[model samples]
Target: MAQFDSKFHDMTEGIRAVASLADAADRLNTIVESYGLETAAFLTVSPVYEEPSKPFYVTTYSPDWVKRYIEKDFFDIDPVLRHGLRAVTLVDWKEIDLSDKAVRTFFGEAREHGVGKHGITFPVRGVDGDRGILSVTSNENAAAWQAFLKSEARDFQYLAGEFHNAIGRIQGRPRHQTVCSDREIECLKWYARGEKVKRTAEILSLSPRTVRFHLDLARAKLGAKSLAHAVAIATERGLFFQKLF
Candidate 1:
């Protein structure tokens, strides 16, 4: 029992040290692979403001599924996702019906890919009004997959939440916005491009005083001691989409 306890502690700590979303996903894939399970499908969703029917944000998903879903625009017929949002706990795909002809056709096409027929989806409620879903699919029976998920539920949920939070911070949509805004984002974008405040002001047809005001605001929003520090913060938060160097 002591040895088992030690191993559990080590596993938890090791997973916590994963620094990026990609790292976390790879780690999860490795874990499932180790158990002789093939996890070909994984997806995360967050809240989207427009379209009440489509309030969830699909933060990440398999590239193949993304293209197929978009090309087909199956969101309108994705009954499982629609029902899952209303469920209070993790749901199994088998429990939801795809009896509708359109829904049935979509699932049939998805099956041609490696995506599983059944899976468990964990709903993640974040700080503020944001919410998300972390789904894992398997080709096996829903009951068997659910049992496996139940055994590793805590670890799976932890990894999912960590991934989501990391992405949120990188996407500049963190639960707690330390320093970020539209003005700060604009200033940082210009700063990254090697533009001085005077030149930036001239380009924007603003006075030097106004440029300084924007810069100051950016510094405050970024929690930076200087203009350079602010730019660094913005870059890490994914505001600078282009390569600076």
Candidate 2:
């Protein structure tokens, strides 16, 4: 039981206000692991506000799929992303049909990557801001998944909402805004390990000067008074993945 709470404590420490999109995705992935999910995503409504729109912000997606989705400009016609923006409840992916040629193609690729047929998407709507969706997915059977959701859905949604709000505030938006990168976080993680500039540089294959630059950027984004403070904030906010130094 102590071990169980320790896992939750790790989660609580790692989900901080990230300054990059990749960092946000990484954090969501961490949460997904706790629930035995293979994948999770947070998709937000685009500013277009037109018919058949898609989420402008979709985290931790395959680069290939994201590139294709953007190249094809699918947001102009994706039914799921459209419905997701307006929904205020958890929607099962299987319930939606994508018989259209384009939709089928896109979803087919996602399934090929093991996204699974069963999924639950939590729709988060904000008043006068960018609405968002936090979805957890697995290959588990639909009925069992639904039962689990019935028990834990509201709490998960509430937490997702709070996380969404925090991300928005950091990005200077009321709704959703994209920020953060993998490298920035990688650098921060080294800092959290108590590595000095030169040492962290050697570990990351970056120059000592480059290490300082990334730390500076991290500090500014986290509103930290110093490097130590930034590390503390990141740990408190769930930004670091490894054991804290």
- Measured by TM-score, the strongest candidate is 2
Compared with the true structure, all predictions reach lDDT values of: 0.58, 0.64
- Weakest ten-residue segment in model 1 by summed lDDT: 1-10
Q: Model 1: which residue pairs collide?
A: 46-57, 179-221
TM-score for each predicted model, relative to the true structure: 0.54, 0.58
Q: How displaced is residue 240 in candidate 2, in Å?
A: 41
Regions of candidate 1 where Cα sits further than 4 Å from its true position: 1-21, 40-63, 141-143, 175-245
Predicted structure 2: lDDT = 0.64
TM-score between candidate 1 and the true structure: 0.54
